[model samples]
Target: MSDDGRQPDDPLSRFLHGETGALVFVREVLTSVLAVALVGLLLFAVSGVWPPMVAVESGSMEPHMERGDLVFITEPDRFTPEFAHGDTGIVTYETGAAEAYTTFGEPGSVIVYHPPGSGGSPIIHRARFHVQEGENWVDRANPDYLPATSCEGVPACPAPYDGFITKGDANAEYDQVSGIAPVVKSEWVHGVARVRVPYLGYVRLVFSEAVLVQIDGGADGVVPAVGGERVSVTGSERTTTTGVVGSASPTLATGSAHGTPTATA
Candidate 1:
C-alpha cells in the first residue's frame, strides 16, 4: 500500500506519483502530443486549414523557395488581397505584374491547388493567368514558356472550363505544357503560401520518407504529398510541376519545383 492509502501498484497512483517508469514515459508522450495538438489547433484557427504548414520537397520554386523549406499556407479566402481575382482572392502573375504585387520575389501569389482528376497531392506553383471556358489562352501565354505555337498544340488550351495556368519559377515550361497538371480550377485551390522557413521541413520529409518505404516497398524519395507515397517528377533542365503528381496526399499539399525543370512538391 502506498502512504496515501492507495495500492502501490495502482496505475493511477503510480502515474500520479511518477513511480512507474513506463507510466511516466506514457505521460510524457501524451503531454507532448497534447502540446502539438494545441499548436496545430492554433495554426488552424489562424490559417483556416488543417496542416497549415507544408514542406518543400523540390527546388521548383528555386531562389524563391527551396527543398526542405517549411512553408506556411492559409486558405485562399483567409486574407484576400485587394487585387485578387474575383472571390478567389488570388492574384495571377498577369495581374500581379500589372499591379506590382509579388510573392516569393515575383508577381502573383504562390498557390497550392489540387488539379482536377489528379487523385494525388496538390501542386504548389504561381498562378500565371486566368482563362475563361473555351477561351484561347495561348495568346496571353509567354512564348518562352509555351512549347507549342498555337492553342491547338497545347495540352490544356481553350481554358478547360475556367482555371489558372501555373508554372514553377525555375522551370522553362508552364505546368500545363509539360503535362505536370491540367488547368487549376478555382475550386481546386486549397491554400496560398504566405511565408517560408528554410530547412525546417527536412524533419517531416525524412520521417515521411521512411514510413513510405516500409509501406510501398520503394526507396525513400520525395516527390510531393503529405504521406510516404510520391509521384516522381524527374528532370534536371526541364522541370514539370505536378501533384501527387508529388503534391502529397489529396487532403494535404506538399511542395516542389517541377518543370522539365523537374520541380515537384
Candidate 2:
C-alpha cells in the first residue's frame, strides 16, 4: 500500500498524482501530441481544407478584426453565397479611387487569400466587390473619389482578371495599391474567415516575422498598427507607413514615394 492509502499497482492513481518516471512523462507527452493531431485531422476532414485556421498579422481588417486575432477560415465553397462579381458581398473600390465609405453588416465577412503572383503571405481583408474581366470599378460611396492618375491608360480597375476587389474597412485604398497584387477567381482566392478567437494569435504573430514578410511582403509586411494593419500611400513610389494612429500622421489620401511605382487601380 502507498502512503495515500492507495495500492502500488494503481496505474490510474499514479497518473493522477503525476508520480511517474521518464517513460511515463514521455508517454503523456506523446498522448497529448497525438490527441491534438487527431483533433486537427478531424477538423480538416470536416472542413474539407488543410489550413482551416489563420492568424491575423495586420491591422488592415482593424476595428472589425484586430491584429493577433486567431481567425477560423473555411473553404469558400463550403459556405453559402460563394464570392461573385457585382451587387453582392462587400463593395470594394479602386486603389486610389476610394477615400471614405461604410460597408454593411459588421464590416462584411473577412477573407484570407493569396494574392495572385505576389508570393506573399495570406491576406486577411474583406471582399468589397468583384470585378469581371475588362470591367471598371468606381466609388459611389466616395465623394472626392479619384481614380489613380496612373490608371488612366489601364484597361481594368483592379487587374486584367475576374475576381473580388478587397480592402481594409479603415483603409483609404484598395489592396492593389496597398501592396497586394490582385485577387483572382481561378487563381488566388483562398478561404473566408467564419469564426474568430481573439488575441491568442499574438503568440504566433510575436514570433512570426519571416512568416509575416512572406504573408504580406518584406516591405508590406503587416506590423500591428494603431489597432489596424500597416498603412501605405502609393504614387510614383509607395510610401510605407507604420505605427498607430495619432502616434504618426496619416498618409496623404492620394499618393507618396516608397514602393515601386505602378499603374494605379
Candidate 3:
C-alpha cells in the first residue's frame, strides 16, 4: 500500500480503483488501443503480412467462404506447398486437385490479389490455373467456365502475358470472361488466405459502410477507371482502358465484390 492506501506497484489495481473517473476513462481507451495494436503485431509476426486479415463483402465466394467472414492471410512465399505454382508459392485448383492439396474447403489456395487493370479493391478468389504468355489457354480451361468456344472469343486467351486465371466459387462465369478481372499476376497478389473466422468481418464492413456513406453521400456509383476515365459497366461487358489491361471497372462486379483497401475477402 502506498501513502494513499492504494497498491503502489500494481498498475491494474490502480487503474481499477485509484484513478479519477476521467483519468480512468482515458486509461481504458489507451489500454484498449494498445491491446488491439499488440494483437495486430502478433498476427503480422505470425503471418508475415501487414494488415493480415481481410473482410469478405460479397457472396461471390459463397458456400466455401461467405460474406462477413474474417480471413487471415499470409505472404505467398511462406509455407510453400510442394506443388505451388513455381516459386510464387501458389497452388492452382488444377494443381491442387491433382496433388490432393486443399485450402478454405477447396482444392487450391484462396488469394487476395489486385485485379490486373481494375482499381476498386483486391479480389479474394481461387486460382483456377496458370497460363503462359501466348499459350492459347482456352482449350485448357474448364469447359463449364468458358463462355466462348474459341480463344478468339475470350478476352484473355492466348494468355496476355503469364498469369493465373481466377474465379469466384459461386459466380457463374470466370472473372476474366465476365470482366471482373484479367489474368492475375503474382506480383499483384497481396496475400494468400490461410484461415477464416466467421462473422467477425461484419464489424469492419459496418465501419466501411459508414465511411462510404460519408464520402460518397451514400450513392453507389460506378468506380472510376484507371487513367481517370469513367467506366459504365453492364452485365459481362469487358472494359479496357488505353494502355491498361482489360477488365470490368475496378468495382469487381463478379468476384468477392468490394474488398476494402489493405483489402476485403
139 Cα displacement, candidate 1 (Å): 1.9
Alpha carbon deviation, residue 225, candidate 3 (Å): 18
Give me candidate 2's TM-score against the actual structure.
Answer: 0.62
Comparing 1 and 3 on TM-score, the stronger one: 3
What is the C-alpha lDDT profile of model 1 across 91-199, one tens digit per residue? 9999999999989999999887655555433557899999899999999999999878899998888777888988878766887787667788889776777877676
Question: How does model 3 score by TM-score?
Answer: 0.76
Cα displacement (angstroms), candidate 1, residue 48, comes to 0.9
- Per-residue CA lDDT of candidate 2, range 61-174, in tens? 656655555555455666534232332333343321243433323434455554434432445566655666666555422322233544453324535777776666656565
CA-RMSD of model 3: 9.4
The superposed Cα distance between candidate 3 and the true structure at residue 244, in angstroms, equals 33
Clashes of each: 32, 13, 0
lDDT winner between candidates 1 and 3: 1
lDDT of 2: 0.42
In the range 1-265, model 3's lDDT, one tens digit per residue, is: 6889757667667776656777688788877867766765676677675556665655567677765566666789898787899988899999999999998788988777765556544667888999999989888888888878899988888887999998877766677787667788899876777776676555554544412322122222322111011111111122121110011111211112233121322
In model 2, the worst 10-residue window by lDDT is 255-264
User: Can you rank all candidates by TM-score, best first?
Assistant: 3, 1, 2
